[model samples]
Target: MDKGMFWAVLAALLVFSLIVATVGGVRDAIVGYVMQTSLQHAQRDMAAAAVRQRAEAARQRAQEAARQREALQARTLAPDQQCVSGTVVTVRSNDASQLIRGGAPVRCSGRLAEVPLR
Candidate 1:
């Protein structure tokens, strides 16, 4: 082959190699960026899930505590008498200058009754 032709072919091959290398590098960079973004999104989603779980757990605990409080109040206020009687009257008036009040005092008089154990 002629020397000039050989030189031309070598230069063409060099340029082609450079182009291929550059395109491959750009492709690798794009893939890496996409993978990184996906990973970040996954991490964010996981953190949000954890936060939701913790909030749900806290809500459940508060509900349980409230239920326990109500139960205790009920047990304390339960009537333990053979005969129990009480009167409660609530009065609400929207009149500007009128007073309203009338109710009998709560009273319990009876022999102690047996309470069953839980």
Candidate 2:
């Protein structure tokens, strides 16, 4: 081939290779960006799911505690006759003086009336 034609062919081949490389690089960059965005969305979704699970657990615990309180209240309000014989232990000096004025070793007996649940 003549020197002029060979040089022209070489320059053309160089330009073609550069174009291909540039296109490949751009494609790689776009793919990387898309993958990064997908990962971020997945992490956010996982965090949201964790928060929802924690809230549900807390709600369940609160409901269980409320049920326990209600059961205790029901037991307290049950209709049962009983006699309680015990000394009223004073908490402080003033309370002791009041108990002394009323009298010591007080005995009480009563039946709790049944309460209707609303």
Candidate 3:
């Protein structure tokens, strides 16, 4: 009777250990899946932020271009014809590029012709 009892107890203990191991493995898998999903979400958010930053920069560049065009038009329409005949102006812009922004000046050969006074 004593031997039978010992065998029964050992079998029960083995079955319980197997159940616990399976539960532990399932828990670990769930944790890994959650972490992967979170990382992917973070990457997507970073990409979207970069795109928005580029778009904002583009909008600012367009505004600056408009302002420069207006200034050029006003200068060209001045009554003094000699002021625009061979004017050289330096155009500076943030979007002009790294090569042009660092103390590099582009020589524009266009003249602001004077408009006739009404």
RMSD of 1: 11.3
Q: What is the C-alpha RMSD of each candidate to the true structure, in Å?
A: 11.3, 10.7, 12.6
Better of 2 and 3 by TM-score: 2
State TM-scores per candidate: 0.64, 0.64, 0.62
- As a whole number from 0 to 100, the lDDT of residue 91 in candidate 1 is 35
- Is candidate 1 or 3 superior in TM-score? 1
Task: Give the TM-score (vs. native) of candidate 3.
Answer: 0.62
Better structure of 1 and 3 per lDDT: 3
Residue 52, candidate 2: alpha-carbon lDDT: 100
Full candidate order by TM-score, most accurate first? 2, 1, 3
lDDT of 1 by residue, 15-56 (tens): 999999999999999999999999999999999999999999
- Model 1 ranges with Cα > 4 A deviation: 78-118
Give the alpha carbon lDDT tens digit for every residue of 18-107 in model 3: 999999999999999999999999999999999999999999999999987777775452222222223333334432221122354222
Error of 2 at 52 (Å): 0.8
Q: Which stretches of candidate 3 lie over 4 Å from their true place?
A: 78-118
Candidate 3 global CA lDDT score? 0.61
What lDDT does model 2 reach?
A: 0.61
* Ten residues in sequence with the least summed lDDT for candidate 1: 109-118
Number of residue pairs clashing in candidate 3, backbone atoms closer than 3 angstroms, sequence gap of 3 or more or interchain: 0
